[model samples]
Target: MVHIQHKVKAFIKLGSFLKEYCEYSKKPIDLVGINGSNLAQFHEKVTLATHKNGWFSQENINFSLLQWSELLTENNLDEWLGNYNLAANNYKTVAIIMAGNIPLVGFHDFLSVILTGNSALIKQSSNDDVLLPFLADYLIQSDPSFKDNILFTEGKLENYDAVIATGSNNTARYFEHYLGKKPNIIRKNRNSIAVLTGNESTDELHALGEDIFQYYGLGCRSVSKIFVPVGYNFDTFFKAIYSYHPIIHRNKYANNYDYNKAVYLMSEFKIFDNEFLILKEDEGYASPIATLFYEFYSDKTALLEKLKQDEEKLQCVVSDWPEMKTVAFGSTQKPSLADYADGLDTVDFLLKT
Candidate 1:
């Protein structure tokens, strides 16, 4: 078995390659090496990915790589693993079914499986596919020992001892029927939301705009809805979010906005139509692209209680309230490695299994 230290070093080297990749992807620079292999393949993968999936924009892909570059460091890795004894008495082949909403959304699970000495069978999402394979390639290049441990599949998953699948609520039903017997972690539809106190600073609301618009509200961590006090003025909020007005220029986003806005008008649904974003009074957690659902909360205590009760449906709660388990504004999508999806720890689960 490959020692854990070797695996960590390989990932750390991959991180260095990623930083250089992001830099060169923006403006061509001198190529560097990972284990003596120049990362020209990194640029090739990014081009193919953006063409294959239009939603996987270069900026978004680079953002994911930048975050991973920061995360796959020695100190961060040590601190994240300090709480667990990673000795694997029994190793299992864990199948990872990834989601493509955001770039490299499934890398954390892939990292967990390998770091715990378990073999990984990854089925990449067709939407955001190319980045992870090249990453896995870098791992193999950094350490030849990883060749047998990391695998990517395009067919039906087979011969896996455990599973980790992420998808919509409808797809989760199918996952439950098929993989329920295995030691598994199945995730379903969950969205992040923001709570407003009406006294928030301009900087805080500006940060909240990033939460609402980053990745075009495609990731589960993006804030789709907001809770505000009764009779709260949205003019202030709108002024703060004016910086992101360029989102309206994107053809795909513009189409959604125009289509949804026309539908609301035809149906006589009263909505606040900002040129870039629409505000509608809705009770649901999930909001469509270019639209934000707002719910009026009269009491903070009651709202907190309800949020606690309905926690399973939430990926994150962005708020200025320091007392709650709420993340700060603009930070729902910037979670640390320990911030697991569905509030379940993947590494611990893999180690125990």
Candidate 2:
């Protein structure tokens, strides 16, 4: 088995390559010791990814790359892995069934599997099939040992010891039925919510817009619903998010906006519209694209209690409320390595398996 430090070093090198690639536009002449041909190949792959999935816009893909580049630092990796013992007498093959909702959505699971000295058998969602294999190639180039550790399959997954599968509530049931016999993490649907007090500054609300609109609101961490005080004026909130108006120009997003708006209007549901976004009083957590669901709360205690009761359905809570755990405004997508999805510790799970 490859040593844990060797695996960490390979990831750090990959991070360095990603950092340079994200900044490549600023320094066109300097390859910065990165393989020039490989850099070109990665750019081509990014273009191919966009062509394959309209939702994977160039800007969103770059944002994901920059985030990973920043996160894969030695300090961050060390701090995240320090809590667990990584030594193993034998390595296991872990199967990862990925989701394609956003770019690199399954990367954290893949990373956890590799870092724990296990082989990864990845079955990628067809919507996001281009990028991760290219990244795995980069890791293998950095250290040839990774070539044996990573495998991608288009057929049925077999010969794996454990599984980590992510999907919608329906698909999750399917996954549990087929893969549940193994040690597994079957993740289902989860959405994020924001709590807004009337006193939020324009800047805070503006930041919240990032949490809502980034990744075109496709990520599980994206805030799909908001809780506000009764009779809260929304003028400030509207103005703060007005900067994201250009998002409506994207054809796919515009199509969703127009379609959902028509359906809402035909159904005689009262909705607040600004031509680009529709705000409806919805108790549901998962809002359709280009729409935001909202509810009014009268008592903070009761709201917290309700939220606590529904914790399993939530991926994040964007708020500054001191009584409960909260993610800062606009920072839901920028989770740390330790921020496990569904509040389940992946590394710990893998270590035990």
Candidate 3:
């Protein structure tokens, strides 16, 4: 435990140094033990992929960078570090089975583990292979001491003090079967929701659109369903989100939009459409395409009852209504460092021996 405390302090110092480098250079420091040319290529990939409209939308790109900077800054990381009490904790390694729902979704977990004096044995998601290593390169360059603590592997992970696994509901069964004996944080598929009272302004509704469609509706944090008044006007809501039309025009996104549209039509599903968006009433929260999913309700009490029935499957809920604290909107597209999950701090999960 004493050793872990020393190591975490060192890591905080390292975080501080790397943050200074990023702010001063305005270039991500991916140059370390690896080749300089390769680092350049990786940075180029990040820039091109983010800037190009074909791969990601403008709002998505902007928000992605916003989160990257948030995680890289000294002020944010320091606040995150202060939130933990690592004095009497010790751990050798923390195995992370990361999810690939959005770009760099695993980054927060990685930072938490490393900063809490635990070595990370990462089993990278096929969907998110690039981000972790890119971050590791910068950390390794900022301070050589970090190289020993981070290991990327496809090999078996056992005898670790703790594990953090993120997957779908079906995969949670497998994670439990294999890792049931160890202290673990196993995350299942959970969708976010939004609650709208009739009092929302136009700006508030437009901002909510960013939360719903920023990652093309692929992220688990993305709002998959909106609870609205039964008599809500589809025209007013769609108009607020019409600015995102260019995003739907991308080939990959358009393909999803077209395919889902076809399925809705073929099934003779009832849908309301204007020039900007589609309004469909569905039972499930998750949607198959890049569309805003919704469920209209006549009464708030009934909606609350329905939400309670599926509380275990929900990750976060957003609302203009004040009763739900787990809910957020608009400016909260990038969550702060304090947002814990499964009722546990990730850094604490890592540091517990």
Candidate 4:
């Protein structure tokens, strides 16, 4: 634990250093690209939402960055930082297959493999190639020792003690069949869900929209579908979420909304929403492209049963409804350091291997 403390301090200090450069001096750090493409993408989303979706408020960027700083300081660094003495000395390499839906989605995996004292063999997602290598370069500057451990390439998987892979549902079977023989954690496409009772406050509904709209709704953590009581007032819900109007206005996003809306309209399907776009559903998960949303329910009992049946497809559930353990609403995009993938801590995984 003493070693962990020192490493944590180092990480906090490094993060503070980077923050100072970005927030105050405007000094650009070539690596990490936190202020480069990553921040650019986020800014682009906000701009698009303002112009297209009619949602203009910058709700949580500062708060999220503060939380990120906190995560750097408070999370156990030995668990994530290279602790050569603690490693079993058996595993020499850690192969990571990363996801790219949200901005910097693969960062945690990159951190896990490198910080746990193993060589990283990364298969960068085409969507996320810019950020991870940028981070690798940043970390290398922070500690020259890290240079040897981080690697980027494209090819077949090599001999490694453990592996972590994330993919869509159709590809999960292949990941399991091919990589399961080795010690691995293979992730499949899973959607975040929401459970709504008729009794939620307007504030709660507004916050839920943040989860759905943040990151332009591209994250696995984004609430793709909603579950609400049958008699809930559509007017009340729409009014509560109108603050997110900027999201529907961005060029790319507006195009998506327009395209998806046209498709649904041409099909002669009934739609819901004030003016933006929301779609009602009969059954099944996932929303359509045009600023779409869904809701369904017979009763709590049936809802739980249905959710149980599709447990494997679920990434996380955000709900104010009864019976949820870790449901979070507005803060969906802001995952803390402790939220482990597959409920497995990377440090513990590395130690075991």
> Residue-wise lDDT of candidate 1 within 1-353, one digit each (tens)?
34988998888888887887777777765554542245566777888998898777788888888989999889988888777888753788999999999999999999889888889999988997788887887788779989988888999999999999999999899999998899999999999999998999999999999899888899999999999999999999999999999989877889999999998889998899779999999999999999999999998889989999889999999886976788988787788989999999998889888
What TM-score would every model get versus the actual structure? 0.96, 0.97, 0.85, 0.81
Over 151-175, each residue of candidate 2 has an lDDT whose tens digit, in order, gives 9999999999999999999999999
Give the residue spans of candidate 1 off by over 4 A. Answer: 29-37
Clashes of each: 0, 0, 1, 15
Q: Of the candidates numbered 1 and 3, which has the greater TM-score value?
A: 1
lDDT of 3: 0.70
- The per-model lDDT (C-alpha) reads 0.88, 0.92, 0.70, 0.65
**What order do you get sorting by lDDT, best first?**
2, 1, 3, 4
Error of 3 at 149 (Å): 0.8
Candidate 1 — number of clashing residue pairs?
A: 0
Clashes of 2: 0
Best by TM-score: 2
- CA shift at 317, candidate 3, in angstroms? 1.3
Give candidate 3 regions above 4 Å deviation. Answer: 1-39, 45-62
- The residue pairs that clash in candidate 3, if any, are 317-327
Q: Candidate 4 lDDT, tens digit per residue, 1-353?
A: 34334434545665664354335323333446544554444344434433432222333333333445556654455343444455454446888887766545676776666555567888877655553464466556556666677777778888676888888887789988888888888887777778887777899889988778776776677788888888877777788888988766666667878787777779887877555656657465666544545766767988888888888767678876566555666777777666765565766677677
lDDT of 3 at 19: 39
